[model samples]
Target chain A: MTVEVDVTIKPKRGVADPEGENTKKALHLLGFRNVRSVKSMKTFRIELELDAETTGDAEEEAVTSAVEEMCEKLLSNPVIHDYEILIVGRQIGN
Target chain B: MTVEVDVTIKPKRGVADPEGENTKKALHLLGFRNVRSVKSMKTFRIELELDAETTGDAEEEAVTSAVEEMCEKLLSNPVIHDYEILIVGRQIGN
Candidate 1:
């Protein structure tokens, strides 16, 4: 089975984002005075292949495990950032 | 004028991405051994308000200037990162 996943990681509110702050300041200079706030984030779309009789259970388990491990190990900073995941593909046994 | 812009910044190839590298290793452990490579990147979607007779020229200028400044000053390290921008909105004098 082939699966595509989209993941986004962003700094939690109240955490300082220097890049976001600087962008806001630059916007102000560019005549966008009403700009409220800017936030920085990371997004990724990944394609993976798995082996299973159906796309439902096996693929789900593999994707979930892979993403969880990825997040814990590298995709995000547990202390300051949060992540969201989206799985899109044909469901098995559907 | 109101505009929405999406920006992405990523490390250039040949530049080591420690986070991405760590994630790839983690994925391997999770049974995704066939995974080739992983790259880390940042994305931002910004909404801004500008003043002008039309959403076209005013917005185009404002967004372009703001993004350029943001990229140069904070969003990326010119030496090792690159950025891409997308503008989506109603064009003026369409």
Candidate 2:
């Protein structure tokens, strides 16, 4: 089975987001005065090849755990960013 | 009234994703061998200020149109990326 996950990462509250700030400035320059703020986030759509026998609840749990581990290990900086993991779908892989 | 929208931008199908590729390599090196592929995307959560009286359908439509314009102008590169807009919520701003 192949499980697909989307991990969204965003700067923690009170943390500086220069990219977002820059974008807000650009929008203001472009005459989008109604724009109040912009928060930029990074999302990773990851496909994982899992054991064929794992299905249903087990598959969902397994993918969630693995993806969380990936986020803790590399995808997110816990000190500055918060991450959310969402299991999108599963497909049988040959 | 304030409308919050999330704009997700991703590389068009078949386009190269070096950041995602690098992340995959790093994950593989970190022993996440099950990772088949990773596609990275950018999301912008934009808050827009609108007339206090505009609510319901008119508000929703106005926000959507303004956000689409933003995506077309700066949030996304039309040639290599595809974009999606999601209206998240509305709030009364004092």
Candidate 3:
């Protein structure tokens, strides 16, 4: 089974978000005075090939475990970023 | 009325996504052989202050117009990227 995982990683509140700040400033310049603020986050869609038979609780566990491992090891830097893991759906490989 | 907008920007198909590539390579090194691929995108949460009385169609028009202007002017570069604009909700200034 190929599971699609969406990892939304964002800078924690109070952390510097230069990209967001720049975007807000640019919007203001463009006459979007109503644009009060902006925040930017990165979303990574990971296509993981899990065991076809891992079903029910086991399947969910396998997916989360793999997704968490990826997040901890590479997708997210624990110090300044926080991430949310979402199982989008199963994908059929072409 | 303060409306929240989410601008999802992604590199167009056939365009290079170095960040996604790097993440995939990192995952492979970590033994996620089943991780077939990865795609990444940036989501911008723009908080805009609209007219409290601009309700219904007029309100929607104001929001989209401002959001679209921002996207064309800064949030997304049309040549290499494609973006989806979504109206999240309204927020109260606190």
Candidate 4:
């Protein structure tokens, strides 16, 4: 089974958003005044291949747990980014 | 009223996925072969300011339609990328 995870990472509110600020400034310069603000985000879609078939909730639970661990350990920087995860399972490559 | 739109853009399948390939190679170098594949996506959160209070469905519809126009005209490149849109309304600056 393969588990696909969509993780969106963004800077928390009140954090310094230089990229957002720069984009907003450019928009204002371009006369898009109603564009009050913007926030930039990075989204990663990861596919994890596992040996076990997802026959029950237990297998699904295990994959999600492993994905969460990957997030904490490598995918996201906990101090600077807040990440949201969406997971789904499918056959080998489709 | 303030409208928030989240857009996710990616190249269509069968079109090259260079970023995905690079990331996959790096992951393999780190011994994560269970990572069958990966895809990179960019998510932009845009905030639109409008004078009208979102009192009814009409106001909300107007904002989303306007946002869609922005997407078509400025945000995503039509030929090489596919985009998804999400819209929400919030109070003045919160």
In order, the Cα lDDT scores of the candidates are 0.71, 0.92, 0.85, 0.74
The TM-score-based order of candidates, best leading, equals 2, 3, 4, 1
Of 2 and 4, which scores higher on lDDT?
A: 2
Displacement of residue A54 (Cα, Å) in model 2 is 3.5
Rank list by lDDT: 2, 3, 4, 1
Model 3 residue runs over 4 Å out of place are A55-58, A92-94, B54-61, B92-94
lDDT of 1 by residue, A16-83 (tens): 88977887887688665756567778876565666646466666787878776777776778899988
Q: What value does the lDDT take at residue A54 in candidate 4?
A: 58
Error of 3 at A52 (Å): 3.1
Q: Tell me how each candidate scores on DockQ against the true complex.
A: 0.29, 0.81, 0.79, 0.63
Winning candidate number (TM-score): 2
Evaluation by DockQ, superior candidate among 3 and 4: 3
**lDDT value, residue A26 of candidate 3:** 79
Q: Is the docking of candidate 2 incorrect, acceptable, medium or high quality?
A: high
Candidate 2 lDDT (Cα, 0 to 1):
0.92
Chain B TM (all candidates): 0.75, 0.87, 0.83, 0.76
Those runs of model 1 whose alpha carbons end farther than 4 Å from true positions after fitting are A1-6, A12-19, A22-35, A45-47, A50-94, B56-62, B88-94
Chain B only: TM-score of model 1: 0.75
Weakest lDDT window of 10 consecutive positions for candidate 2 chain B? B85-94
TM-score of chain A of each: 0.74, 0.88, 0.85, 0.75
Candidate 1 lDDT (Cα, 0 to 1): 0.71
Measured with DockQ on alpha carbons, how good is candidate 4?
A: 0.63
Name the lDDT value of residue B33 in candidate 4.
75
